[model samples]
Target: MKKIILTIIYILTLSGCGLEQGSYLVGWWNGDIPTKLSDKEEKIWDICREKTKYLPKNTEEEKEKADMELNNCLHEKGFWD
Candidate 1:
């Protein structure tokens, strides 16, 4: 009975840890192309989206610039900020 209780506790702890890790990467869309983004900006958007976890969730938006200008024009004006 003691061993069963320990096993359950361990499973619960691991499940909680998994949930925390999953939550850290929320709001990241998994797609080859964001339909709202332009064709020329799709590549940069994908890169930025994958790296979203490393960026601020609010206030300070992560902007990806290409060719001396912001390439993600569509995404810049949307929910990112």
Candidate 2:
């Protein structure tokens, strides 16, 4: 199961699908096929999607904080085990 998931990730990553988007989708799959995002997950996805827009304007410390917050958000939402 892990291998299959990893393979899919690898393929998606290499297919120019955007690693962040691919990883988010794969993690949210929760071992089943992913067909849609829940409301909460969609909110997180929106944040991630807009990150690049604001991240570059942030200072190093701000960026670090934002990254940590995002990581925590993902973990709290079960983006990964």
Query: Model 1 over residues 6-79: C-alpha lDDT tens digits?
Result: 99999978866645323533324323332475655566556655655354434433333332133354366342
Per-residue lDDT tens digits of candidate 2, residues 5-66?
Answer: 99999997787655464575666655745567777778776766565445553588887777
How many residue pairs of model 2 clash at the backbone? 0
Measured on C-alpha atoms, candidate 1 has an lDDT of 0.50
Q: All candidates: CA RMSD in angstroms?
A: 9.5, 10.8
Model 1 misplaced stretches (Cα beyond 4 Å): 21-81
Off by over 4 Å in 2: 1-44, 47-57
How much is the lDDT of residue 35 in candidate 1?
Answer: 41
- Most lDDT-accurate candidate: 2
Q: Local distance difference test, per candidate? A: 0.50, 0.68
